[model samples]
Target: MEESDIVKDIEKKTRLTSLKKYMWGPNILNLTLIIMVSQQQFLGRLSLLSTVLLLISIALNGITLIFFSKEIRYEENQQGIHKPFNKLTIRLLIFIIIFFGAITIGYFIR
Candidate 1:
């Protein structure tokens, strides 16, 4: 039961590494969501297809965020030191919240 063995086991069980290709999932989904919303504004019409895509993208992003959060806690625990979150992360979280709220309002407005 070496420390390295424990860390490796944890990683294997969780299947989460911040450096993995899927780490881009959240960013890509976020971009897609914004594009879907913006297209409606420019075209000036309700699009059921865009709405369905937006919901799917948001759900996928939510799953990605859960993995990201788990990885953050896993790394922090392994380091034995709890660090404050990055300013950029905080700003991005805020931006996501505001945009999500706007989307909710837009969904109801139309």
Candidate 2:
């Protein structure tokens, strides 16, 4: 194939890879978090409402991952997962990292 054709092929493959990650990547992380939380004992007492909220959040995360996989798979014929990352996604990811980092620091400090 010509140089232009090769470039196009690479672009196509990269897009496919991105879509695959988008579809399946979150589930892996989500499952890992679930496992860690389930295994590790939480120190101190938590209120019933807090526990319920936590369970709800976990369920929502699982559901979201499932829907994400379905949507990504459904777009198999498309060029790629073309979903635009808006403010909410960006903030959510940032907050997730920051929140986890804070928790880790607190764990160590205690």
CA RMSD per model (angstroms): 5.0, 11.2
Query: Candidate 1 deviates by what RMSD?
Result: 5.0
Candidate-wise lDDT, in order: 0.63, 0.53
Q: Given candidate 2, what's the lDDT at residue 8?
A: 78
Question: Where does model 2 exceed 4 Å of error?
Answer: 1-15, 23-25, 32-42, 77-110
Q: Once superposed on the true structure, which residue ranges of model 1 sit more than 4 Å away at CA? A: 1-22, 43-46, 85-96, 108-110
Candidate 2 accuracy as TM-score: 0.41
- lDDT (Cα) of model 2: 0.53
Global CA lDDT computed for model 1: 0.63
What does candidate 1's lDDT look like per residue over 10-77, in tens digits? Answer: 76545535434465767676766755664565646567776767766776776676667666657656
What's model 2's lDDT at 107?
A: 41
Model 2 worst lDDT window (10 residues)? 37-46
